[model samples]
Target: MSEINPSQITFARVRRRLTKAQLAKELGVTSRSIQNYETGSSAPDSETLAKMAKLLNFPQQFFCIEESMPVIGEHAASFRSLSKMSDAMKNCALSAGAIAFHINDWIEERFNLPQADLPDLSDLPPEEAAATLRRMWGLGSAPIPNMIQLLESKGIRVFSLAEEAREVDAFCTWHGSKPFVFLNTMKSAERSRFDAAHELGHLVRDVYSMRHGETRGIEMEREADAFAGAFLMPSESVVANKPPAFTIKYLLKLKHYWGVSLAALAYRFNALGQVTEWGYRNLCIEIAKAGYRTNEPEPMEREVSQLLNKVLDALQAQKVGRAEIARGLCISVDEINALTFKLTRLSVVPADSSIDLVSRRSPGLRLV
Candidate 1:
């Protein structure tokens, strides 16, 4: 009975990663028509609205919801490979961020989540900033067992990047005072951990620097990369535990110890002058030859959200299943799962059919 909200058309389209022309073709209409529908100059009739909802995989009521879609502007977010990513990829990731805001809000309203405890470390160099954070958190050159858990404990909201945004390694942004990180779970577990740390670097450095009129692009990215390397593999630990040789086997052992990719370890070692430039290049070549660049060897288990797990368990205890949550948001259960790290385990019966919940936790996957 509600009138269609034109902006919702755009939100659904972007969330699905479809451009106006592509969606128009699917709907057997002109791109101009789709634009008009999105801009509120005109509205899609019931039939067209139904098709749009179906193609976008959103419920029909979603397009009629009165609430505004939360927007994270391009300038506000720190995206990995921002220059190389297509507009669709960036928008898709940003849309996922909007969904994350909704889910985070829903959780916060009912429970007392951790408050942000991050300090401003923009004035210091990346290594010093990393060390300062380590000292502040009482982590002295020790390897982090779980980056996601640690970040959540510090009141950072972490979510998984859907498969549609796989090209985007990860991204972070501030929604008001709170920080949110989106990690590409499709990547190897080691790479994902680095991504998590990389975003944390942005939270500590880039977010504060931006307020003081600093540019928010590749320069910040370079600094964040350095921070992540130092945060994950402390310089003192790396120097004290320098290997006798930098062979692939030795690199593999170190990779497991540090819980980072081989290339990351190689770069860190080379940066510290332990390996010559020529030696670094050769190590990279050997790593590529072993297909380590594309495929990870001896992967650790993927880290998920401990906070979200607890939240879901609490919700289950209250007899509020995922279906109720999805209905409250006027979205599909699958959409909720996509925004989450896919961690909800209670059985849910969607409007269309039933979905069996199963554990996605990787078993017996230890650092080898």
Candidate 2:
């Protein structure tokens, strides 16, 4: 076991959104002492380490583990509603993602996860990029049956944001060679689908550009929104399916076929010139009046993570469960659930259940 690193204390405190003063109060220490510990001028005693671990809900061993991977930089992550989010909240979310990367590394060692198979279309226009990805993925003009599954199949790791901030719709970043897209699943399914596609746009276009020192501003956001609209409802399909006259009623009815929000469909129509400027203006007004802007009508079912479900199933077969995994990683089961899209089963097993026994004591455990 390694000695406890002072930096790990700072990382954990920051991840929990606790100020140094706040953590010091919780740990019954002076703020300056917390600072000293964080800055490596002092180290926590064993009793202090126990108190810190219990307070943070992290295993004591976690503080001793070397920090192998750094949290992704803010510039590298493409955040939706970036302006509305507090810096602390953003850090909390990103720290969660960093923990997820650690969990993913553990899983990858056990399971043969899919490899990323996406083209770099950083130079192409958003519309062309969407169309190109569609062709590349063999999606053509068909509506994606399951966006999460499609992404998982292509090896883009998708995680649900447990950050209680509603303003943060979604974000995407490329960690090492793999792409990670985090979605705010609290939104309606329609909006979540759009968010996934929008982040995909960032992953495909903005991530590479940002690495090359390209400045992403409002123009990038607009491009991502446009890409999402085009990707979810392809121009060819929209052209074929759109009515002669575009209206909120027509869009509401047509949205199910495209599996997008009515607002998204209307905006796509306006962009494609299928709806006149006057018609689009009235359509937007009508949509907002009907509360379609904030809430989607007839929302599709939420897309669950297919890859996570399979991984859990495989682990179950090997007599491994959430508690075991969490204990092994020196994290909480709640953290595991957050990283795995809340797919981890939480129900208590019967005392007499054989499955519980198997989970508690499994011999020769290996991933199939």
* Candidate 1 lDDT: 0.82
- Give one digit per residue, the lDDT tens place, for model 1 in 1-368: 49888888899899898989999999999999998998889998889888888889888999898887798786678876676689888999999898888878876766778878999887889999999999999999989999988998888989888778878889888777788999888888899899889899988977655444345867778988999999999998998888898889888888989999999999999987889999899999999999999999888777777888777766665566777777767777776777674433444433442322222221121111
Scored against the true structure, residue 267 in model 1 reaches a CA lDDT of 97
- Give the CA lDDT, 0 to 100, for residue 320 in model 2: 69
Q: Which candidate wins on lDDT?
A: 1
Over 4 Å off, model 2: 164-166, 210-215, 342-368
Compute the lDDT of residue 179 as modeled in candidate 2: 88
Q: Model 2, 1-368: lDDT tens per residue?
A: 45777777877887788999999999999999999988889888989989999998788888887763366777878887777889888888888888888778777767778888778888899999999999987888988888888888888889888654345788887778888988887788888899999988988877566565455688899999999999998998898887967776667778888889888898898899887899889889888999988888888777777777777776776566777777667777777766555433443222232333322432222212
TM-score of 1: 0.91
lDDT of each: 0.82, 0.79
Give residue 88's error in model 1 in angstroms.
1.0
